[model samples]
Target chain A: MIRRFGSSQVSALLVGLVAVAAFAATYGFDPVPDGLPGLGAVEFPRLVCLLLAGMAVLLFLQESPPHDPETAPPIGRDAWMIFAACLAAVPLMATIGMLGTIAVFLVVAGRLWGETRWPLLVGVSLGMTAVIWLVFVKIFRLTLPGGWLFGG
Target chain B: MEAFLGGLAILLDPYVMLMVLLGTVLGIFVGALPGISGSTTIALLLPMTISMGPVPAICFLGAIYCAANFGGSITAIMVNAPGDPSASATALEGFKMAEKGQAGLALGMSAISSAIGGIVSIVVLIFAAPLLARAAYSFGPPEYFALALFGLSMCAAIGGDSALKNLMAAALGLLIATVGMDLTTGVERYAFGVMELSDGIGFVPVLIGLFAVGEMLDQATRRFGKPAIIALDAARVPGMAEMRKCWRSIWIGSGIGTFIGALPALGATTAALIGYNETKRWSKHQHEFGHGSIEGVAGPEAANNAAVGGSMVPTLALGIPGSATTAIILAGLIVQGVRPGPHLFTEQPTLLYAVFASMLAANIFYLVMGLTMAKFFARISLIPPAFLWPSVFALSLIGAYGPNQSMGDVWVMLAAGVVGLLFRRAGFSPAPLIMGLVLGGMVEETLKQSLLIFGDDLTGFLHRPIAMTLIVVTLAGLSWPLVARLLRGVRGARA
Candidate 1:
């Protein structure tokens, strides 16, 4: 017979499965040398994995309720958009530089988040970039990467 | 006396004081804004503080922490939006008081009681931390291991939606902590061919991602409609007569907040909640509750602010952070190469004293600011999330990179942000995971040392009295819930 699982059960099952996988991966770790009087790298992690697995199984059986904060709303399309933009910025930082990346991210994010005016987006984008340049680069003297396109 | 005087001197210095002022201003600003909390702000600013000396850096962060608790009450009172989670208790009656056109009175009570509570807790911190540190001199590896375990055991109880999920998050953190080369075996475990991972995950990046960028993503999920503004008089400070009415509750809240906050893994939010409850339990005007209750505002506001100082005790003395904000502060301490513990009091007494002084000063600053400029600070809540959050995202990316100047760290930050998003959706607290990450290395190191010293005999832990005592305490704490349940079942059967 097949059993249907709820979110909490799914969560617990996933955690237990990952812990078991990690327990399996411990074997790939090198063993402690004979003369060394200390633990192998996997000893502590291995112990933790077992504990986690045990706890997950218990949780699965218990079928606890989700502890969502009172204020938090469900993740919407906008969150995914922001997450994607954030991920895209990391690679873009190498190609387009810090300022360029910041500007691109702000404009794209602002527009996508439903801002109508181009001038306002451009203002916020450039304004933020300049403020950061002054604070981090000029006044604080922090190093920001110039990217492969422009040398710092 | 010399250390105390030296600390006061640091507070008196123009540069340090300026930074403290800046931190206080920024703290109130962000603390009065919903969706941007003090913890997130501290994480965002951590990298920028790398150039500053540790003393100023700590003072800046400390000032923000102290002021923010009070600042959170501003939004809670004005709009029923608690800018900081700690002020949720305040929002209940405070918003009612606002509806009753007693916003000024409630705001006044919150400020005065918050100042008194904050000062009381700082006084406790000043005396309590050094005494707590002295006890640490007797602790050995096994003792520390037990202490770490005791801390981890509490993770199931603190700040989370579910106990099991909190434990899972912490386990995940411990896994993350094990990514670098092992200090004992000189063997790499899970670097996965990444050079940055060889040194282990950088605390700064992880913290930035978890608190700042993660919060930004959470903010992105939905739009905030503006709450109706409650008009309040900034000049209407709580009068002497009003103070007399709330005197008992202010003290009760302060005492409870300090005591709860000193406990491992507890913080201001819990303190304020209990404070609110106890204040109701003991209040003469119980009828005033759930309406426009000035005592309600006073109790929780004081409790949360008091907790700010109380939480510092463990973070500074035991290196076990009592709250998420203190966790960030502890990370800052570590980032500045200042290892916190018993030795710190002896080695850096002046610095410790300065931190205490700055916290004291911050309490006073926010009280004055909260009372006078609250009307203005309340307006900050009106700032559009569209403008505010995008700026935060930009800064988060830069802040993540500023630490190691490596794109890899930025990549890690982004990944952690996703993890943070998942964590929120899954109903987990990031605090336990942070606690696990912070204590993971020490737990392994101490356990290894204990084993080496004991010749791999697990029973050797039985010989260390302090360690044994801590282990027993941990066992009891973890079992108490089950014991209570069993007792209840037996009683029901008998009845």
Candidate 2:
């Protein structure tokens, strides 16, 4: 039972529920104000929030199945580092646009992934930056920000 | 018939044909990338496609959708990871084939089955859509509500071993759907007072954050080292005997896909799983299913491709989305000023024909692209998680923010990513939740409309012949699982 409702899963669910409730409370009972005119007409995003909350509850209530902890693969420090890096990326991307952030992120990330050749790392990072810019900006013509530091 | 020919003439225009070809090739590359679903590719391309002529845009999008469904299998076959949810079943056998140095054969089978499924679905759609629309128009509000009920009920059919969780997820979706302003009363239920909350949450950011960013985070947390890329064998095509063995699974998969695709909410993943399980039940070596049987690869690949065609039925005929990708496609239709419904055929026969021809054109392109690009696409699995995760993260951010040029959407994407990560850790799928959110509004509106029209008389709900038939069908569908379980229990007791 302890294994099923591990500290990680429980805390995650609790956090999610609290966040959802807070989001709901921020606007009071009237969640959507600009909704299309009529009674009971719902839109997609609000529905997603509600579903996520419900899923959190359901997940919390679920009885944990038994498992042998020893047999499961070890969650290594390296994995955690990767997780930390991913989490940190949101803030970094917010500060720097895709090209600058990704270039730096890739070089560091590539080394973490066990790439030994510095030249390969630089080459790959530059190549990826070019491709993303060309495809998303040049070919597709989608608006991708370049941050305040560089002209978008 | 004449309309179809005219549409075909338009599709045959060199520029349109070129767009279809280019779209299919691009789709294969995107689909080959792990965690890049067909829907995301379409969403990303949508801004650009908006400017193109409607027929060409439809053709390009159709080609992309069809080819991407097959393209995901390339990575699944060459590596253990599924490129998209629909290819998850294929990865079981396909990756095993790669492990055994038969990667080429697995790739060949997936390509062939996908092509067959795509072509068959197009043929079915070309004929079945008009009839379905005609019958659906005979439906009153009550019947439409019943149809929504049927779609919602199928949520129970998704994922592994948790009908309760799926129901809970869907209910949560429906409840959240109520947060926006009440269409009838103009009162908001859960918005609090935030101005942004007034319009409700946007779909693109949420989708990008949940699926793209969430997936990258999950990949980051994996304990094992990434799968090593096996050296490519230049020539390793399947033998005739292997093709003969998989033919049965392919046909069964395609049939299941077409059937489920026609249903409003079931989508491709459901069809693929059902097809995979059904084929396994009929196979001589059923025990080998998850252990990497070729039948498993063939069935799922076929079903998923066919589902692409199947999911389009409602979108084209009724202006309803049968899946997430179709929902996005519906948005595109609205952007192009084409209102899809019962009157579409009469009001715009050439447009209808154009859509049909585009579907056919996409199928042919899928076959060509899948065959030529399989080996190259297979290489995507080798990119280290460090590089892959950050890049995908960047794309997720850009894609989420691109729609409205809002930094707020980017933050929303971040929040959704966190939520998505939590859902993954708890072993609950976010797919059904996402699907429910996309479909929830449509379902609720139809139900309320029906109730308003019928007043307090419950039996009046079934006054329409089509409505009565749909309600009965929905009831039967809901009871199917319980009935099957009971039968199994009874047989076991006797034994």
Candidate 3:
């Protein structure tokens, strides 16, 4: 017989499965040296994985109520857009440099968050990026990505 | 006494004084903004402190820590959006007071009580930390192992709604902590052939992702309804009569805050909740609760601020963080090459005392700054999220990259951000997970050493009385919820 699971249960199950995979990966560790002290590199991780899997199983068994309408609003398209933009900025930083990526990211994020005026968006995005560059890179002397394209 | 005087002199330096003032103001501004916490502020500032002297760096962070608690209450009172989770109880009564046009009075009460609480706790920390360190000086590997275990277990117990979920998150954290080369065996465990992974996951980047970026992502997804416009024209210092009325509640809350803050795992949020409840129970005007009572504002504000002092006790004496913010501070100390624990008190007595002195000065600054700026700060809640959050995101990105200058760390941050959002959605808090990761290395090393000494004999733990008692306490703490439920069930049946 097949059993249906809720979203929460499915998430728990996925976590448990991941733990099992990690547990299995521990087999590749070099065998413990003869008469060498306590449990080695693999033992503690193995134990943690076992406990994680067990707890995940228990979490899967617990029933949770469906989301209420007043709270827990559905994840909207704009939210996903913002998340994608953030994720994209990581790789973009490698190509365009920190300042360049941040300038573009701020504009895109502002637009996604419902800012309508193009001039304000452009000004704010560039202004914020410039201020951060001055403080973090110039004054503080901290290194930010210079991009492979810039000969950095 | 000389140490104390030396600490005061360090704080009084022109450069150090500037750092404290700037840190406190910045901390308040950031703390007043919804979705940013003192921990996140410290995380963002961590890399910048690398170039600073040890005394100035810690003093700066300590000023931020003390002031941020008060800063959180500003937005909580004005807009019903708590700047920190610990300020939620304050929001309940504070917002009501705002609606009734007592916003200024409520702000005054919170500021004053927070100052009182902070000062009281700093006193406790000054006296208690060295004594605790003196006691911890006798601890061997077995005792350290048991203490670490107790901390981890208590975190799981006190964190989030689900004990099982907290444990699972902590276990995941421990697993992550084991990613680098094993310190004992000198063998790579989970590096997966990546060069960066061999050095272990960078905690600073993870912290930025979890607290700052994750929060920004969560904020982007939701709708913030129109916030109340609090008029601060009437805002002023609490009158003598009002102060007289609320002093007792403030005192009691401070006491509660100090006690809870000293314990592992528990934090100001818990202290505030208990303080609020107790004040309500003992209040003569019980009807005033949830409807703009001065006592209501004073109680939780005092407690949470007092907890800052209380938490520093364990952090300095035992090298165990009492909260997520302190965990980051402890990380900052490690990055600065100053190991915290008993030796710190003995070896660097002036540094320890300097931190204490800085906190005392910060409380006075917070009171002055909070009251003087209440009018201006009340208007900050009106800032559009569209403008505010993007700036925050940019800062978070830079903050994550600042520590190691690794694009790899940035990628790790992005991944951690996604994971953090998913965990929050799944009803797991990141606090216990953080505690696990921070304490995991110490726990493993100490446990292994203890086992090596005992030759794998489980019964040998009983030879160390302190270790044995700590182990028993951990077990009892882990079982507390279940035991409480069972007792309630039996009592209900009899009824």
lDDT of 2 by residue, B1-495 (tens): 998898899888998888888778778877877777887677656555655777777778788888888878887777766777788888878888777777877787888888888889888988888888887677666676676666666666665336655655555555545555666656665566656656666666766676677766666556346676656653245678888888899899999999888777667777888888888987877877766688888898899989988888887887656776776676567657787777787888787787778777777776665666566777766666656676777667667666677777777777877767765665555555655666666677676677667674557765677777777887888688779999999999999
Q: Using Cα atoms with residue i matched to residue i, what is each candidate's TM-score against the true structure?
A: 0.96, 0.83, 0.97
Residues A49-80 of candidate 1: C-alpha lDDT, one tens digit per residue: 99889888887787656444544677677767
Q: Give per-residue lDDT, candidate 1, residue A85.
A: 82
Maximum-lDDT candidate: 1
In candidate 2 the C-alpha lDDT for residue B401 amounts to: 67
Give the fraction of reference interface contacts each candidate recovers. Answer: 0.65, 0.36, 0.64
Q: Specify the poorest-scoring 10-residue window by lDDT in model 2 chain B.
A: B160-169
Candidate order by DockQ, decreasing, is: 3, 1, 2
For candidate 3, the per-residue lDDT at B148 reads 82
Report the lDDT tens digits of candidate 2 across residue range A1-152: 54557533574476456547645553544434464333332333345456566656655665654443422334567656766665675567556765677677777767766677899888888888888788768876766666666654
> Per-prediction DockQ, in order?
0.63, 0.30, 0.65
**Candidate 1 chain A weakest ten by summed lDDT:** A63-72
Off by over 4 Å in 3: A1-3, A33-35, A68-72, A149-151, B157-159
Task: Supply the TM-score for candidate 1.
Answer: 0.96
In model 2, where do residues sit more than 4 Å from their true spots?
Answer: A1-62, A67-98, A108-119, B13-15, B39-57, B91-102, B234-247, B280-297, B324-328, B331-340, B347-352, B456-459, B468-495
